[model samples]
Target: MSASPAPKSYAPWLLMLPALVMVVVFFGIPMAYMLRMSFNLHVDEKFYVPGFTFEHYAQLFANPLFTAAIWTTIKLAFAAALATVVIGYCFALIAWLKPPRWRFLLVGLALCPLLISEVAIIFGWWMFFPKNGLLSYALVSSGLITSKFSLMYTEFAAFVGLIYITLPYCFFIMLSVFDGIDKRTLEASADLGAGPFQTFVEVLLPLSRAGLAVAFSQAFIWAIGTYATPSALGPDTLWTVGYLIQDQMLNKHNWPMASAFSMILVAGVAVVMAVTRSFMAKRQAVHV
Candidate 1:
């Protein structure tokens, strides 16, 4: 006959205290520092000066190299994100519809790329795409080509690397989304004479809109910030904002410029996330 304990007003905040502290300490402080630093001056090859100036931010558009880098990053990220989503959707759907005995194996394979560091993964692809590497050897052994073929230092190579890294994120996200879907709805679609592709377009895509949007946004963000894989796998013409940021900070020893580029990157990521949330909300409303 005892009354249930009343819910504490501060309980939810108490549970979130650690995460709030982490966000403030780690993300908030660094962003603030970077924002302040972006306005500082860089004088005579010195790391930075404490004086305020708008030159760093202004050069973002005035400088042709920076403009090209920004555009290249956008194009590369868009292509990579689209490719990752399509491939991940197909793979995840196949895995989802497979027998339970095979699901574990497919999931394990999807997770294999994530277990390795990006640097290690890039190195493996580096070897594979080179003239004397396994891919060339296989092609030669199969008599497909008389001479060795090299894909290294190509946009295709860079695109492949970008897709490889982002695919797992998309796969897992879509898989979880698929898991929450009602199987009977899919069966109903089939019973109503909808073909596989028709059902995918009408039912699967609509049901998984939220997850697809999130996965695409995440992939786009990651692809835009890609620094090493493109530098390693793609041609010198392929320049990204990340490459410029590193060059400005370390090579040019220009902290202000680096911070300015970083602010732009952060802004782009924020916009993508906002769009994703909005898109998801709209989708939810429509479905409801």
Candidate 2:
């Protein structure tokens, strides 16, 4: 024979078959189970009853508490994400402009937080905010205050925690984006008599708009899903969708209700990501 038979084009798909199976087994099966459970009936004594009903979805809107929690979660997440992106952008820009040694130092500091566990981070913040904590002691030692004061169990404390945890991810993302940009453009802008602020607004901002969108979406998703830090640090009034799901599953033993809430949370996040990506794509198209 002049040549052996050629291999099939579908060989690559055969190689991918195990990964596809794993994805369906791990993700798809659980998702289907949760979806089916969401419509099941729930009894006070039992975890769930095997009857389909739309009562849970109806109750989601009917209950003012759940509605309030949804709004509160969205509000805090957006605010925290916006703050994180702004701070991260500035941090990344400074790091980008630094010399090589300083650049590495700044990057090392940014990465330090990621090595620590979220629980430990929250506990550290918890200890720092109470009346008898490090912050109060520092203020008193510095003669800034006559007595110890507490920021514990406040929305501000919770917001700070949210930002602290999400900052590293945002910073690294922006840093990578900045690294891809040519250094010559900034120098050229300065040569053209553009002020620092003007250069940032006209050149840097336009170049990094897509990265900003990505970082915001990432931070927002993280903030919304994190319940432990906020609940532990914040006031009792702060109830998020995450807290609701936890309460339903563990405290209330209402699996159906928890499943319903979980479904809604998943749907909400999916919709947000879809909208954000679509809007950014349209903006990019317009710019081009």
Candidate 3:
């Protein structure tokens, strides 16, 4: 007789036990709490009574400030995402075509913004845009302007800061996509008498459409959540949903409203992610 064979089991599940517990304890619990809080009624300045109510969500649409913030955030995010994609595509394409030595240098430069803290980046730009900052001083010193002029606290400043923060992500995403393309394809296009612009439009752009969609979605998602850079660099009137969430949670001590805003923001991001996934899936199916 032979020894009984060992029983088969899901031993691999043991490895995931800790991660499952952490997710439930951290993310799951907090999300459940926030969902409950979003329905509670606010009483006076400090207290919120437990209850089921839709007033918080209703007020979000009813209030002009919140409505305006929604529009502003979407517009800013879309603009920033589009600009980042265009510039990053150009930068990535150039870097991709360059020698290996130059590619490494360009990649390192692009990663600089990503490595630095957002607060640090905001402060650096803050100092660079003020009337007495490097930019104004340079223009004045160079006799390009009769008087120093600040670019600070303007829409242009906000857009610049947003683009700076989001550009590195777009660059890396597009670079990886560009790297996957065969160099011989471009050569073949050139052999067939295609100009540089023609090759890019006919060969490169079509191949990279999926990557462009992915990069744009990621950049837009990032921009939608970023409030610090824009708030610090742009004018006072530029209020984003993130800023409003902070204000409600800290300044006004309105937990219910804050929770509502956070839930809505999360929902918006989820919708964008779903759409992106569907788009990519369709593209993959078509290719197959």
Q: What is the per-residue lDDT of model 2 for residues 61-131, given as tens digits with 9 covering 90 to 100?
A: 99999999989998999999999999999999999999999999999999877999989998899789999
Output the lDDT of residue 59, model 3. 91
List candidate 3 stretches off by more than 4 Å: 1-25
When 1 and 2 are scored with TM-score, the better candidate is 1
Which residues of candidate 1, in runs, are more than 4 Å off?
1-7
Better of 1 and 3 by TM-score: 1
Q: After superposing candidate 2, which stretches have Cα over 4 Å from the reference?
A: 1-22
Best by lDDT: 1
Model 2 deviation from native, Cα RMSD in Å: 3.2
Task: Give the whole-model CA lDDT for all candidates, comma-separated.
Answer: 0.94, 0.92, 0.92
What TM-score do all the candidates reach, one by one? 0.95, 0.91, 0.91
Cα displacement (angstroms), candidate 3, residue 40, comes to 1.2
Candidate 1, 172-211: lDDT as tens digits: 9999999999988989999999998899899988888889
